[model samples]
Target: MTTDASQSQAHTSAKHLYQRHQSVLPDWLAVYYADPIELTHGEGRHVWDAEGNKYLDFFGGILTTMTAHALPEVTKAVSEQAGRIIHSSTLYLNRPMVDLAERIAKLSGIPDARVFFTTSGTEANDTALLLATAYRRSNQILAMRNSYHGRSFSAVGITGNKGWSPTSLSPLQTLYVHGGVRTRGPYAELDDTAFIAACVADLEDLLGHVRSPAALIAEPIQGVGGFTAPPDGLYAAFREVLQERGILWIADEVQTGWGRTGDNFWGWQAHGQNGPPDILTFAKGIGNGMSIGGVVARAEIMNCLDSNSISTFGGTQITMAAGLANLTYLLEHDLQGNARRVGGLLIERLRAIAAQLPGVREVRGRGLMIGIELVKPGTDEADPDGAAAVLEAAREEGLLIGKGGGHNTSVLRLAPPLSLTVAEAEEGAAILERALRSTQF
Candidate 1:
């Protein structure tokens, strides 16, 4: 068939598929772009659309594709595990599960850490909530403003992002706290030291008013809230306050774990004056897209539950195998170091490009997890339309990026695979530069 004819056929097929998807899928399910491309497959840091158009995938399937797409180590482990057995209930001893849990516990930094696997970050966080509430004997919880934990009932209850949380009614009593987003909010004007102090004071006041709260849950870097983060030591300061009250500190490392931030293995370490959080929940990139989630906590808190509990699909042999392989590859290759070097170069390049663009508001974040917030030219107002235009334009330029933010979703989120190379970084930055240029009004 002629190229034109083939293009027409591809468009028709995509349209038909989209219509079918809309007919069946929930209306609230958000898809990227005006014309969403169906990704057929991916390798390394790139993916191809159904129409055979290839793009550098910067979002990495929302950062779930950690080390790389179709990583050979992970794929081989998954295949090998499937050959033996895909799953065995928690009723039986699972070697892979035990192995992964051992590694995570030592790495967790929590005293006498114990790990419990779950199927998704939402489930992992839900489990953390259960543990904290049961241990503390209170349903009142503290969360950061503009934070997003997950979509489940318990997770959403603690989520402070209005854009993602659908309902106000929740099983847990959640109090939204300050210091999540550093660029905006009442504390934004303060210096880092003052900001930390202000947030700590807010927590202290909130704690005094409320009955014994279960725990304080926070994302080291607010992922869905546009890669925003508080001052480095904010959490450590809060840890001091919470320790006094005996409230647990839960680090939601769903997006910030596995050395993505470069300087720290865990995001909480950026604020590491305090020992470690009482609990830590992680998912997205652990299995490198193989579906693994978990929470790590001190044995005392984790063992608080009286009833027997098991996530039917959590810690299945196949997923555990994948996690083991993925973690090994990441460590062996020192992909965290790569993320540091390449991501630093990429962020500097983006900042230089942003300096020349009037609509570019700010360039922020550490390592591979970066956010470029766009705004109205010569003003502080967020420009969500400009962000949308840039996302669409980036796709046209054969570069796939992501959009997010608490303020109207105007921040361009970039989290490529940890294994992204220097050449890929330059290429993706050039494409992004052109995309940002296209958004200039």
Candidate 2:
């Protein structure tokens, strides 16, 4: 077939698939680009569409592909474990599950840590909430403004991001606090020191007005909230107050865990003054695209529940094997260090490009997780349309990226696999520079 003929056929195939998707899927389930591409397979940091078009994948399936696409070790482990058995439920003694849990527990930094696996980040956060409320005997909870934990009913309640939270009704009484996003809130004008003090004072005042809350849940770096984060040590200051009230601190590391932030193994480690959080929830990346979510907490908090609970599919042998292998690759190769080095170069490149664009409001985040906020040129107002145009332009340039924010989805989120090479970073950044230029107001 001629090249043009093949391209036409691919377009038709994608159109047909999109029509079918629209007919069956929920309306709220959004897909990228005006014309969505069906990804058939991926290797390393690149993915091929069903149309045979190749693009550098900078988002890494929302940062779940921690190491790289189709990593050999993980593939082998999953294949071998599947050949033996897929699942035996939590009722059985699952060796892979136990092994991963042991490794995570030791690395969790929580004293006498215990790990419980779930299927997704949402489930992991749900479990943490369960433990917190049960142990503290209070349903009131403290959460940072513009935060996102997960999509479950309980998780939604605690989610401060209006874009993600669908309903106001919740099982727990969640009090939204300040200081999650350092660039947009009332404290935005304050310096790092004053910002921390203002946010801490606000927390103290909020606590005085309400009953003692079960726990204060926050992401070290707000993921779905456009990768925004408070100044380092802000959480540590809050910890001191929460500690005085015997309130537990839960770090939701769904997007910030496993060294994605580069400088620290866990996001909370950036604020290590209070030791570790009482409970920590993680998912995405540990299994390198496999469904593996878990919560790690001190033994006392993990064991507070009186009733027995088991996640039937959470720690299946196959998924656990994948997680173990993926994690092994991540640690053995020091992918975290790679993220620190490569991501540093990438961010600096982005900032230099952004300086030339008036619409680019801010370039922020750490390690591999980064966000570029778009706004109206010479104005502080968010420019969602500008962000959308850049996203489409990047796609046209053979690059795949993501967009996210709290009220307006105007922040471009870039979190490639930790194993991303410097060459790939440069290539993606070059494409992104052109994309940003294309979208200039």
Candidate 3:
């Protein structure tokens, strides 16, 4: 559909450059082979390749840059803060750390939720596990099925995916609840609020059998698990159960937090206005692509930590400054509302297309987070070969897309930043359609 001569030249040049000069990509990154079009810089929702060709980026660096790319305010804050203080030991107090803590606490309804900063989401989840184990003195962790916490041992132990890596297997400390409480032919919806109530009921039954549980970990939307938004009343149900059992409610908002899902700063708000988690961990989007993570835990748990304990370099001045600036723009510009409006429009458009297209199965998620399931000519689950072809074709067409289903079952996930436009959404979907149509599947 791109008829402009300059655009064609740019894409062709990049392709040739990759073919002629670029080294073979590393094996670790081989799991997700990026498009041959290597990027150089970006502005707003669009990114440019080495050849100066622009692509509307719907992926948003895996939903890390929530406000947009090259944000003037955020960049200025980072520059100013870095010039002043790059890194400092945790032995002293920092201004940005204190302010970010206050901001996070005010947004999270928990009155005394204490913040602990880390360098990654994995670390936050890992620390949350350690805290839970210590608090309850229990070994068992109750993780929802299809949940993705992190790659750490404790997190990988709880993750439902078995073959994530060869060494991913661990002593089974996790349990998988059926994706949705209701059973449909192939896929289904979570029947209103009943799904959460059912999940709670199931948990109660399981707890009656188990000796004890330390923590229950889950995401607001199972990001890697087809972006399935947890059912309504789900958080409150989990909260009540954990409160009664004196267990930890750990909400892994690494992917769903920071207003990606709209109407709130965190995904727990998806359930209700002020629903708060006992221990909430955030990483992605906190530093706008910088590797910074932290947890906002209830004071009940924080109080358990000794005064001298829980000190780390996770909340340095530079990272906190970037995070604060990123969040300020998101809040002040009302980007969360943009995510809701644009994402809703995208859902409607894609759903309309799916109504007529072969292999089109489901459209689900919130904000700019989306998952479009691709099946075979007639199949209940995924057709892996077909899915692979779709991805391959999209890559060849100069667009970048990611597949996010835990079991190698296929789904093309769209988690663009909050600033994606209706035109870009349509173009992306059209490219997907063209790929599917061209492939052998």
> For each predicted model, how many residue pairs clash, with residues at least 3 apart or on different chains?
0, 0, 1
Error of 1 at 218 (Å): 0.5
Worst 10 residues of 2 by lDDT: 1-10
Global fold similarity of model 2 (TM-score): 0.99
Candidate 1 — which pairs collide?
A: none
TM-score of 1: 0.98
lDDT of 3 by residue, 148-216 (tens): 777777777887655443364564466555432123312345565566666777788888888678888
Better-scoring candidate (TM-score), 2 or 3: 2
The candidate that wins on lDDT is 2
lDDT of 2 by residue, 249-287 (tens): 999999999999999999999987989999999999999
* Minimal lDDT window, size 10, model 1: 1-10
Score every model by TM-score.
0.98, 0.99, 0.88
Candidate 2: Cα lDDT at 124? 98
